[model samples]
Target chain A: MDSSKVKVVTCIAPVNIAVIKYWGKSDENLIIPINDSLSGTLSMDFMCAKTTIIASPELQENTFWLNGKEQSFNNKRLTNCLQEVKRLASKSLPHLNWKFSIKSENNFPTAAGLASSAAGYACLVSALAKLYEIEDNVSFIARMGSGSACRSMYGGWVLWCKGSSPDGRDSIAKQIAPASHWPEMRVLILVVNDERKKYSSTDAMKRSVETSELLKYRANQIVPKMTKACIEAIQKKDFEIFAEITMKESNSIHAICQDTYPPCVYLNDTSHTVANAVHAYNEFKSSNKVAYTYDAGPNAVLYLLDSSVDEFMSVINYLFPPQDTAEYYKGLPLSSNQLSQDLKMALNIPVQEPGCLKYIIHTKIGEGPKILTDPQQHLL
Target chain B: MDSSKVKVVTCIAPVNIAVIKYWGKSDENLIIPINDSLSGTLSMDFMCAKTTIIASPELQENTFWLNGKEQSFNNKRLTNCLQEVKRLASKSLPHLNWKFSIKSENNFPTAAGLASSAAGYACLVSALAKLYEIEDNVSFIARMGSGSACRSMYGGWVLWCKGSSPDGRDSIAKQIAPASHWPEMRVLILVVNDERKKYSSTDAMKRSVETSELLKYRANQIVPKMTKACIEAIQKKDFEIFAEITMKESNSIHAICQDTYPPCVYLNDTSHTVANAVHAYNEFKSSNKVAYTYDAGPNAVLYLLDSSVDEFMSVINYLFPPQDTAEYYKGLPLSSNQLSQDLKMALNIPVQEPGCLKYIIHTKIGEGPKILTDPQQHLL
Candidate 1:
């Protein structure tokens, strides 16, 4: 290979929201979680992180640009990811001894509490792996950048095993089911309007590991059974079981957040109102029609079947009326419908003021990261 | 005694906020708690429930009035409390057969989330017992009315023991320390302004008992040690340990609420902001100068020594400034002091918009029920 030759790779990766949330780390350096967690990889057609990597001997040094702005390469996690990827690449590709330039951006609002970092890192690692001709799994290398990034490497349902090995070689994400297995599944992301400073997940989870005893108990006792049940639910296509487990696990994870010393409060008033609305909706249906899960912020991620989408969207509109209904929903189209008086009575939650949720994203389970063979998609 | 002769008694009772919370019930009917709890009784001068009880043969039937409004006597807990008080009185005197009338009112805002019911029940029971000339402990009678009411029947530090027996006869509030034991201790109740419908504590705790596994774990494993540590801290006047335990227990109880299926959300955004401010204030001081405990509402009850009051008040005013500073504080007066530049910089929380808090009440440890001798003080 010519030493001065430039190689470029571009990829888009999905964002995964954990049903059985990953909180504390058993090993901070290796990004080994204290508990097994599972998540649904969202469709990249609606939301994704796109990245391009350029490697050339002509480049001066390694540099990173996030969302059109230059960010320092001096970050510990960023440096670790680059070094690990290079180490794995140098074993087979001698021409990999070159400076790299990376550019990444999220299609959706980065400040909306979506797991942009997970998708961003997953995309970067996938693109880098392809550039160096490393065909093996790069999820572990993504895990070094962001713990949840490992789960984003797979499609459909992914489970991150909390392996016992100290070296963390066995602690990798595995695909529980492909997106095709649950084609009826749909997701609605309710982006809450908040202006408060967000608590950093890295710092929050670190404190939880050091201080929260409930988190420890949850890791040791509760999550193993929950992860198994979730897997079974997904395999059997049991929406009711999946919904209950999803909501309960979400609450349990937030319970651990609250139990942490000084307590990390992620769910705000609007988040609570959204949760109450979900419970009320389920109670009205007399069955599990929809499930809600919150990550490290107030935004709510709802899981439901395609059959329930029209009715549930009506209910969501009735309870939390948007300021501009035309611009309220993004991604997949939703049919507008009127809510019945019985449902209005059943979901007795007071109608929230207009625009409690900034907007909602309609998407579904989707494939893993995709390499863009067209040079037109490249960022640099 | 003449059958038409009327006997009247008027009494005032303090409100107690638990440092270690009592969440679930072992015996729902008997009102026996699943775990022990500790609290501090706020001074009656600032906030209390005054009740007047009258007994006479001329009365046609039993009746109750709360806050000058006629309330139905068919309420289960109220009827149970009345019947129990009569049974105890009948054992000592036959004149107790006369019909009884009760009137009660709280000085503070009923909708502000202060423990008004606790104070109301305690005052009613105390006044009723005096009218019937029953001198024995009436705290157990108050417990029949409300779980936390038992704690309000004592002054200063109070502990409600979660008795092991099925009968709940041993489940009673004991005075851990009197008001004079720690005169320097002060309380500031920050009433958060909210328009949302409040979750009923009775329903919330019942669901928590049935659905929350963490509540069971916390009741059985956590409260005992916490109660002991809090008592030791109070006895030694160790404000640091006391503050740490108070804040942790508050967070733990809220954690159990979140862990409940469907999850009960009691703390609002303003409530969370107040908690963050408390933590930030402590972090700035490099010591635990203040502690905050929230009941089942948005209101925050803070505990601190008198020496730290001026500095902490300045911090609170800076973070959550009032719309009208002149009308911001109620009860005891606070010395207005400017926040130092260093302290403000150290407490790096963003200043909140004006009037996040409806008002603040400054009070201290005070005696329990007080019998008023003057006829002018009677509610009737």
Candidate 2:
């Protein structure tokens, strides 16, 4: 085995925003929710995690940098993720023995509720799998880090099994549809300011563990039904069904967050602006077809048909002139009139009498995660 | 039965903010939610809708004014409420007859979560009941206008019933605990900037009408349990239980809103701020428990115990410091260190600092709807 040669493995995974949200976790230890949720993965280059793992003798300790912040290497979750990847990697490359250093960051914003970590860890696991040529399943590895990270393993539509497996070994994300299955679908990512959340995902989950009971009911009744709906929607390429499920599931997850005693963290107004903007655009769009879903943060990941691109762009330009619009729109609900009123006053980046998404991508359906061997380049 | 020597009787009702939320519609047409929701009649100095009911034999039309804009008099729901009130009034005053004219205005700094109309109609019924000297209970008349607004008929801690009646006739607002019941209880009304809601309460109700199965589930499962919890909390004057129920119910209603097919509106950062502010206060003042709940709009109605007012004040002053602390706490999620970072960059307002709430009220509790025979001056 050529395992002794310096080994560097990198993995990439996309984020998934629950349409049927997983807001409250009943069992924090296992990351078991009280409800079953439905979510859709965004088909964009921006919303994902890219990770690099190096097993080297020179590095004396297991250390890391996340999004460039040299964070405490002691986080149990990160440790768990690293351990899982190494164990799997070791199975295939047993001769490689050394200290490991992993660096991870999200292409998308982290923890405003969109599931960056899910994608981040998923990619982390997958990337290591690729780097070491591990035979262990990717979902199995990602699950050890975060519950929903496993869902990030697939591209189009994925489902996380709230499997009854006591240790959560069987609970993993399964792809319901491949990205090639729906080539016409489009997702518009609105990075609502990259503010770090008040309560980290872990803290909020811990709160839900103690307070919410509806969460328990949700995990049981609603989630099961949502999973089935997700399968049926993507199979038929039914946007209406997919969108409806996506929105409802996310809402439900947010609801659980709201209901979780002492309350859980959620996306703010600017985040809400994304929801309203998407809603207005969908209403006014010719197909009335766009769908929106959010992760833990306020950023909105909207999916639409290609025909509505121009209209989506026009509406976004009108609603969010990009700078202060994100500020004004953050504290208020998006009204059709507010767009015009906002345009009248916004001079920072040109009236943006017609605005633009920070950057718009004309992406079609997508495949699962892919490694980027180069820097300063879009995925080819 | 000379309905009045004067041709018309004019009246207005202040919109009540739910310190404890009334969420989930048990009877959609009736606007009844599952729990026995609780609220404060706010200081009413500013947040009020004025309505005048004029009777004239020569009048040829009926009209309604919302913030000076004329609305079509023919909406079915409005008609249902008006007719219901008149029917009740006529039963008491058999010969009182004249074409009725109504004018209304909301002194709200923000658009009502559309709770204004609920208050207006409830007040319309209340004022008319007094003017016409109706024999039927005000509760009965209030119900005709808006099921929940009926609770506003009386000040202090009010409750609206989500009873099991097919015709929705039994659903009425009742006083479980008055403001006077707990003289030390205080409500801090955090008025987020007033912008019209993206979805009107009317449109939201329609969405709930068409797509919300969870609305039904809530009414059947969650609300009933919560209603009982609310009653017990009020009876015992237990702030912890009261706060728990208030917040839970609010989230439940919001959850149903999420379940709506097209989805619905929500609070932004400022709203999130009010919530996080209360939470931060709770964290600092573990003994001086203050809890908050939001209705349909972004306005935060927080419940504070008389015993812990000072701690709440200090926390409010600190988290939302009079000038920039070391954070940005104002926009949303007041509990986060990032907010602290933002607060560091911005000016923070202390509680002792002027202009925190639109205006703080020192009143303890007040009685149900009352008429001012001498209208020289009135806060209500």
- The numbered model that scores best in TM-score is 1
Candidate 2's residue-wise lDDT over A1-380, tens digit each? Answer: 14464456666777666655655554565666544554456654546677777766666676677888777877777667666666656554653566667788886445445566777778777866776677665685576677777777777777776667676666667777777778777666665554434567678767765776666666677788877877788799888777767777777667667767666656665556666655655554433476777665556777777666555555566556654444333211233333344422331222222233333333444556777666433221
Question: Model 2 misses residue A49 by how many Å?
Answer: 5.3
Compared with the true structure, all predictions reach lDDT values of: 0.89, 0.61
- The DockQ value obtained for model 2 is 0.42
lDDT of 2 at A299: 60
Q: What is the C-alpha RMSD of each candidate to the true structure, in Å?
A: 2.4, 7.6
**Native-contact fraction for each model?**
0.81, 0.51
Candidate 1 lDDT, A1-380, residue by residue in tens: 35358888899999998999999898888898988899999999999999998888888888899999999988877878778778778565754887888999999989888999999999988888888888777788898899999999999999988778887777888899999999999999999998887899989999988877677778888888899999999999999999999999999989989998889999988898888888988998899999999999999999999999999998888888889877788999998899989988987788888978899999999989999989899988
Strongest candidate by DockQ: 1
Task: Give candidate 1 misplaced runs (Cα > 4 Å).
Answer: A1-4, A57-60, A86-92, A324-328, B1-4, B90-92, B324-328
